[model samples]
Target: LATGDMGIANTTPAACLVAAFTGRPPEEVTGRGTGIDDATFERKVRVVREGLSLHRPDPSDPLGVLAAVGGLEHAALAGVILAGAAERVPVVLDGVNADAAALVAVALAPAARGYVVAGHRSVEPGAGAALSHLGLRPLLDLGMRLGEGTGALLAVPTVRAAAAVLRDMATFEEAGIER
Candidate 1:
C-alpha cells in the first residue's frame, strides 16, 4: 500500500509519538525539520517532550497513543497499513511521518509489521530511530527530509527491480550454466 500527504507540524507529532513508543529522549528523537533554526529546533524538541509527557502513551493501547499524539496523516497511514495487511499487500513507508504511522499500525496489529517495507532513511532524526526500532533497513538513504512520499516514490524503481529479479531473472539451472 502506497500513500502520501502534506501537513504542518507533522514532524513534531512524529517525534513525540516515536519517543513515546520507543522510550527515547525527545531530543534524540527530534531534529531540525525543514531548516528550523536552533531556537525553533529546541522549541520543537521541547514541544515533543512535553507532548509525550502530557499524553503519557500506554504502549498496550495504540489508539490512545495515536489520539493523544498522532497527526491526522499518521492516523491515515496507520489505516493504510492495516488495510494492506488485511489484503496481504506490502506497505512502503516514506518519511518520518509515514514511519510514525507504521509504528502505530504495528502497535495496533502486530501482524501488520510483516507487511511493511521501509523505503528509505529520511533525514528526520526520528525516522532512523523508528526504523531501527522496527528492525527495518530502508532501500535508500539520499538524505531526503521531505515528507510527501518523495523518498518512497523514488524507491519504487528499486522495488520493481527486486521483484523483477525474483520473478523473471533466470536461475542457474534454467540458464544451464556452471555455478
Candidate 2:
C-alpha cells in the first residue's frame, strides 16, 4: 500500500494543487496548517495564492501540476501509488498529504483509485475535507495528526485481519458445528 510523508508547509502546495484542479478559491482549499498564528496564516495563504497564480496548472497535464505546486514527498508518493496500481496492489493512504497526492495520482490515472484505501482520519484541518472530496471514508478516527505514514501503518493490521477472516476462517457447516 502507498503511504505519504508530510512536513510543514506541505499543506500549502496541496491546497494550491487542489485549487488548480478543482477550480476552488485558494481560501476554500487553504487551512491553518500546523496551527499557525493569524499573521503566519495570512502569509501562508498569500504564498499559496502566489504559487497558484504562477503555476496556473494545466488540468490536462498531471505532471505539470506536480512540477508546479507539488512537494517532493507528494510527487514521490504519487509515483508510488501509480506504480502500485500498475502492479495491481492496493495503496492505503495516510492523511491529508497522502490524500492530496492520491488526488493528483487519480487525476492522472483514474484506474488508480481502485487500488487505494483511505486508512484514517487526520486532525489536520484540510484532511477531512480532502477525504470527502475523494469520496473516501477512513477506517479509523483516532484524531491522529502525525503524517509520517503513521495512520496507514496503524490500520494495516486490522485490514490484514479482516482479509484473513474472509479467506481463512471456516464456516460452521465446514467445521461440523451447529450455527
Candidate 3:
C-alpha cells in the first residue's frame, strides 16, 4: 500500500498522514523508502514532521484521517478493503503502509476485519502497532517490507490452500480413519 514515494517527500499525502497519526518525529517512524541517501532521508523525515504540523489525524474518525493525510493509493486501498468486506472476501494485508491503511479501513468498518488477514510481519515497527490494534496475526514472518501487495500476493496461495483444506478436507470421523 504505502510503498515507494510517488511525489516529493514534503508534498506527499502519505507522509503527512503517517506523521499526524504517529505524532513521532520522522526519524522515529521514517525509513529510506527505496534506499535514498542520508540527505534525502533526512529531508523525508523533516517533511513528514512538517506535514504532521499541517494536518492532525483523529484515529476515531478513520475517513477524516485518510482525507487529512492519506494519498490516492491509501484511499484506493481503503476502497478495496471495504469492497472485500461487502462481498464477503478475505483481504490479505501486505506490509507497513498496508498496516496503516488497514487501520483506517478497520476504523471505518470494524466488521471488515472479519474478512481480513495479515499476510506477513513487516520490518516497520508501526506495522506491528497496526496489527496489534486490529488483533491480527500474520501467517508469515519473513521480516519483509515489500509493498505493492507483493507480500500479500506471496501469501495468497497459502491462504487459498488453507481455505481449501478447511472447506474440503475430511476429518478422521468422516474419513473413517484412526485418530
> Which candidate tops TM-score?
1
- The C-alpha lDDT values of all candidates are 0.86, 0.82, 0.69
Query: For model 3, how does the per-residue alpha-carbon lDDT over 74-168 read when each residue is reduced to its tens digit?
Result: 77777777888889988888766666777677788889889888888776655665677679998878866566567787788898999999999
* Cand. 3 Cα-lDDT: 0.69
- Looking at model 3, residue 38 earns an lDDT score of 97
Predicted candidate 2 versus true structure: per-residue lDDT over 1-179, tens digit per residue: 84968577788887877777667777777887688899988888899889888878886798899899988978988889899899998888887788888888989999998888889887765566667767888988898777778889988888789789999999999889996
Report the C-alpha displacement of residue 135, candidate 1, in angstroms.
Answer: 0.7
List runs of model 1 lying over 4 Å from the truth.
Answer: 177-179
RMSD of 1: 1.5
Ranking by TM-score: 1, 2, 3
TM-score, every prediction: 0.93, 0.86, 0.79
lDDT of 1 by residue, 1-179 (tens): 56555767788988988987888899998988788899999889888888887779986898999999988888989999999999998888888988888889999899999989888898888999999988899988998787688878878788779888999999889999998
| Alpha-carbon runs more than 4 Å astray in model 3 | 1-26, 177-179
* Model 3, position 107: C-alpha lDDT score: 80
Q: What is the lDDT of residue 77 in candidate 1?
A: 91
Query: Deviation in angstroms for 7 in model 2?
Result: 2.6
